[model samples]
Target: MNKRMVLILKHLLAVDDPVQSEHLAKLIQVTSRTIRSDIKELGEFLSKHGASIEPVRSRGYELKITNDRSFRTLLEQLFLSNEPHDPHSPDYRKLYLIRRLLLADNYVKLEDLADELYISKSTIQNDFKEVKLMLQTYGIAVDKRPNYGVRLSGDEVRMRFCMSEFIMNHSEKKQDEGLTSGSRIIHSEEMTLIRGVILEQIQNYGVMLSDVAFSNLTIHIAIACKRIREGNQVAMLSEDVKNFRDAEEFQAAQHIVGLIEKELQLTFPENEVAYIAMHLSGNKWFSGIEGQQAQDIGPERLLERRIYELGKEMLTEIDHDLNLNISLDSELLIGICLHLKPALNRVKYGMNIRNPMLDHIKTNYPLAFQAGVIGAKLLESKLNVNIPEAEMGYLAIHIGAAMERQHLNTRAKRCIVVCTSGVGSARLLHYKLKSKFGNRLEVAGTTEYYKLPHVPLHNIDFVVSTVPIPEKLSVPVVVVQTLLGGGDMDHIENLLAGERKYIFNYIREDLVFLRQNFRTKEEVISFLGKKMHASMLIRSSEGFIGLVLERENAAPTAYGNLVAIPHPIIPQSRCTVWAICTLKQPIDWAGKPVQFICLLSIDKNGDEPPSIMYKHLIEIVDHPEIVQQLLKCETYEEFARIILKHNLY
Candidate 1:
């Protein structure tokens, strides 16, 4: 399939609903006529493959797969075939260059790269800027020979780490296409043998690795084998690997290394062996029941205590910064402690693990991901090593699971659907909402609009209505179609996701600054800081600015779409509050531009849940339209009007 077809398929795959041709045209940046023609062509192509696009009179097009196996095959061939990739996509080019550079023995010239990708040399060189940044994170660097070409060079361990990350990524893409992409990296038989040896050793050592984790190890080992054969060996300090030297995991690593060396007829450095053992030691792979029993038989080791302490310190920082109040969660604490054993190793040895769920994790659970960053930074400081984004993503999985565990006790928002049409209609709406939202929403029961005054507003979170409720009630009201259609379901789901936070509670009329002439984030923060200081809410503007900067250092508040939620790194106020400032236009805030700044501050002693304070703010951070509306507001009334219209409170 061509780029246009791929682009169409990508958009179609995003949602189950029939997307309008005009919408698709706008997104694809093409004429509606072009999109209609392309869709027709794509339908024919898909019909021959395994899927077909069904066009509706008003709804436009929806894709249906006739045969899953056939479609995956088609997708694989179209994706994995030798073809020019999407150079315009930063991810595609960086990934392409990573795989190409790793596989090439000689220096790869810029002209050769440009010609291969059908892009200008300048564009190829520009792509290398990102490539260089990514390589630096892994301790790998680009070696330029002035006139010759560019190649990668780093510590063997680090080089292997980069290669594993890139190669495994390519492997996953190919795997999705129902194909294997690593034949040139390792022979099938040798890969099988290597995997067998590793699995046997893991089983013998009584360690449990998820299939993905096992595949990750297999890929890393394969890459290591290839790199080692070419005379590159991993390096590690004696002190750093001392723990691995005498451990049972070390013995397993040695045996695995010995078997691989025997089979491949290549000698490996002892450091490389230790690095292998480090993988076993540091990997968060569960050790079946037997290993747990063995551990239970003995008291906690010194290393375990240290790891636990480190995990505690990280969680403490998370609690201090985000105020998640999950620091004392026994399960969360244990999860992090267990995860750190392997995480520590990965960081120290410059090892990378492919978290297939990284993007999904970041997109779905951003707060947890940011918490993971803080946790990773602490791990970095404690271990004196850099934590790559892939590893940060894994940390997010642990943190996200822990956060989810904490959420188990949270009360689902109690909501009632008002359908005054009749009892049957009201009950239908209630059951439909119950079925759609499940545990996310608690249907308190149906209420007639006429009898809404009798319903307890104290217990109710919100009211979902088939008919408009003209009266401004105590709780938020969401007006939806009587049929409770897809769009309505999404609106309710978004509310459920944020738990319908009280955005009005934190906002203040006096603090809302609209359409200000600020041209920098510093100016915005300074203006907000001065406002807080003038009200005697803060001791000094300088101190508050420093706090804001410190929080920025932890993780930028900018969440894109010209919005930022700057706050002190730690709670510095006696009460929960927010101060807002809008720029005349978007100004650079970190790498992203920001037009609306919401300075969040919380009472460290308040009883409010962490979700209540910042969750609604995250909602605002995600909505460019709301930010735009707020930015346009010249008065607090206008600003509050937009928030009311959004019904976030």
Candidate 2:
């Protein structure tokens, strides 16, 4: 169906309860009558796909699936359809306008564009406001004439880069399926031919590229070919071209261009060949040496010493802030050094490469992503160049891999069993633990309650005691019966999994503010900052709020699900803590709707890594049901109960 109908269907599928038409209208920014009409049409469409929209008497609509298999297939087909986006949708209309202008050969009249989209001229003019803002990011501007309408004007290189972003790339398409945009700048056959030629040449020349890099290079070449035929060519400085010509990729670019010249019957300028070589250099992959030691691999030997030094600095900064303990990881060191070499080239040349795994990395590995942000800040400070979110995402992948490696190398949870009855009872509990947890738990022998203080607790993760130990000890004490019940086992399991039994350790009742009326992100942050300052949690409200805003400016913390976990750029608190606020109405947080704000302040001098805390926050961020429950709570008690019930999942 249309884009709005698809959105309605997706929303209905997300929630179990029936949704009111007013809510749907507000969500889609349409009238209630229009939502009803769309729902009727959607119902007819779904009837044939083994699903239907049922109208509840008091409530609005709910999706009902008749056949699970057929409904799943219909869903797959619906999302995969190549139909043009609905023009009535504002987002789609904006995209349509951008693509039209980018591909236009001459200045087309605004009235003509309005007529083409079946929209009023006033509406098209309104859409141009946002379109202009978007184009401005790429250093492009609309040159509007007196009566001739507007045309895209920018540096030729920047124009092509913008074209690559909005025109050449489709989120749904596979990496190998190159240049499947609606612009049709190059025919499918020509794209295939160009890709095959590049693949053959790169393989022949012993140059390695990831699938994403390979596809991107193909798109760039295709764009260059199309632009050259249209009498537009990229101009580079002579010294820059001379430098690129010295690289190994320059030879590969020459061979690849030579073959494509015969196939396409078009001659590329020497500057264009150098441009291709630049892309090749930026996309190069070093392989088959991941397991080598840092000294043996010698990052300085593989790349410029400056890049290796910067990589070390990045790791040191991340370790200092997040305490990830990965600074000494040899594999991670090599990976970062190798990545920085090409990354620096791409950034210097203003090449914007897409990271396909960015969303997945953000959702699944937030701590690592935070570490990536720290690394990005270091790079920006040292190199005096801005690193984009996409580049930070690539850095996160390396840090994430290293984090996982560190986790794997950690030993199993070690604890001693303390029984009051006798040695036999403690032995029974120890064997039970060994049998239930297997290698995940290491039972470090038995101990009497009276002799617990003599037992070396420093080496233990925690102590499983049968009798009550009133006095506090160095290690955590889990009081259990001589015979462990399911509940007791679950408590032990949580400890083993590095999860806190109570989420209140981080989420304090005094820090929670419910049903606040916040109009903007700044106001919400200001409110939380004041509350934190008043509570003596922070030294300066302005400094804390500024840091949080700085991080938001770098990259938004709103991860959808009506949730946002905003935090300072660096650790600013004495201990890791959260100041939470639930808004009475959802406000726009960097374009995402957010009603739940969790202001995270990481411990500046924490000995333990914050990965587990981030893991729990991600669970809350990813679950819409939890956010919904949290938004409904009017009191701190209600909120805490809900969080404790979920127990940080």
Task: After the best TM-score superposition of candidate 1, give how far the Cα of residue 313 lies from its true spot, in angstroms.
Answer: 4.0
Which runs of model 2 end up more than 4 angstroms from their true locations?
A: 2-5, 8-47, 50-84, 171-183, 287-296, 418-431, 446-458, 465-474, 481-483, 501-503
**Alpha-carbon local distance difference test for all models:** 0.75, 0.83
User: Model 2: what TM-score?
Assistant: 0.87
Q: What C-alpha lDDT does candidate 2 achieve relative to the native structure?
A: 0.83
How far off is model 2, as Cα RMSD?
4.2
Which residue window of length 10 is worst by lDDT in model 2?
Answer: 171-180
> Which residue pairs collide in model 1, if any?
76-177, 282-342
